[model samples]
Target: MKHFHMLLAVLTLIIFVCQALPIWMGKTAKRSAMITGASHLIYTLLMLTGLWLFWQLYQVAGVQHWAIAKLVLLVVAVSATIKALRNQAVQPSQAKAGMMIAAVGYVGILYLAMAKPLLG
Candidate 1:
């Protein structure tokens, strides 16, 4: 489950990059039907697997602070990606900023998941 979750995370990041790069380059990002479909599927799987893993962790350790932080990071990442991808009216600069925010969110989530640091 962990490996699968990791794979989904990577796929989600790749999709975000693919969708964001063209907009960042000042080009209209016209996503193909396949990429769009795959992205939706990947996002759904990622959320389900993530929740399951969180539940498993909670059962073992009783709601770690880092886990809650990770959930917040996940929201940040996904919300930014959606804001950048869905709105055609968004300026290129804004889109770039959104993607950067999402990248940071993803990095933070990954770090928290891997390190499992003790937090207050």
Candidate 2:
């Protein structure tokens, strides 16, 4: 399950980069039905697996601060991605900023999940 979660995290990054590259390069973004569907499926599975992992952690060690941080970062990352990609009215600069935020959120999530730090 942990391995699967890691795989999903990598895939999330790959898909985000692939979709955002054109926009980042100041080119028109293109979307295909297949890529859209795959991304949705991947995100759904990722969230489910993540919840399961969190449940396992809770059972073993009670609540952890890092896990809560991961959850918040996950929401931020996904929300920013959606805002950047789906909002047709967003300016190019705004979209770029949103993508950067999503990237940082994802990185933070990955770090928190891997480190599982004992934060107060």
Candidate 3:
């Protein structure tokens, strides 16, 4: 279970890094965004499976906040990717903002998972 969780985390990190790379390189962001979104979808499924397995094996309630936040961010990521792909002329600022929000949410999710802070 631990190994599975670690692998999921690593994969998610890779997806995030890959998604952000094109922006830093000043290339066509849409292509990379699509790839990143797809990677995120894969990561989400894997993470869900890992969480279910962990719960089944250890009866431990995982970080629900992080999981929920991640799902929300993934939705935003997908939406942004779709919009960018459809309208190549869309302002880069909009895409950048969306990506920034998604990245911030991802970081928040990681913090919540690591700290397990009390959820009011």
Candidate 4:
């Protein structure tokens, strides 16, 4: 289950990068990533699998601050990604800011998962 969760996370990362490529590399083909059924599917699976994995972990080790923090970060990251992809009418700079926020959120999620600090 953990492996599956990690796989989905990696796929989400790749899809996000692809979607953001239009801003980063100035290629229009990558813009197709913004509104694809595939992107939606990937996000759905990533979220569901992550929740499933968290449930299983919670059963074993009980809840921790890192787990809660990671879940919150996941919400923010996905929200940022969705906003970034959906804002076609906004200025390109604003859209780019959304993408950066998403990326940072994802990094925070990953870091929390790995560090798993048991905050008091």
Estimate every model's Cα lDDT from 0 to 1: 0.86, 0.85, 0.60, 0.76
List pairs with backbone clashes in candidate 1: none
Per-residue accuracy of model 3 over 1-120 as CA lDDT, tens digit each? 556766776676676666555654555545555766667676677667755764564456644554555556656655654454344345666555555665676677567567856563
Model 1: lDDT equals: 0.86
Q: Report the C-alpha lDDT of model 4 over 1-106, residue by residue, as the tens digit.
A: 7788788788888877877877645433344544577778877887788788778888998877787788788788888777766673455666788788988998
Off by over 4 Å in 4: 26-35
Candidate 4 local accuracy as lDDT? 0.76
Q: On a 0 to 1 TM-score scale, where does candidate 2 land against the true structure?
A: 0.91
TM-score of each: 0.88, 0.91, 0.63, 0.83
The TM-score, computed over Cα atoms with residue i paired to residue i, of candidate 1 is: 0.88
Per-residue lDDT over 32-60 for candidate 2, one digit per residue giving the tens place of the 0 to 100 score:
89889989999999999989998998899
| Each prediction's number of clashing residue pairs | 0, 0, 0, 0
Choose 2 or 3, whichever is better by lDDT. 2
Ranking by TM-score: 2, 1, 4, 3
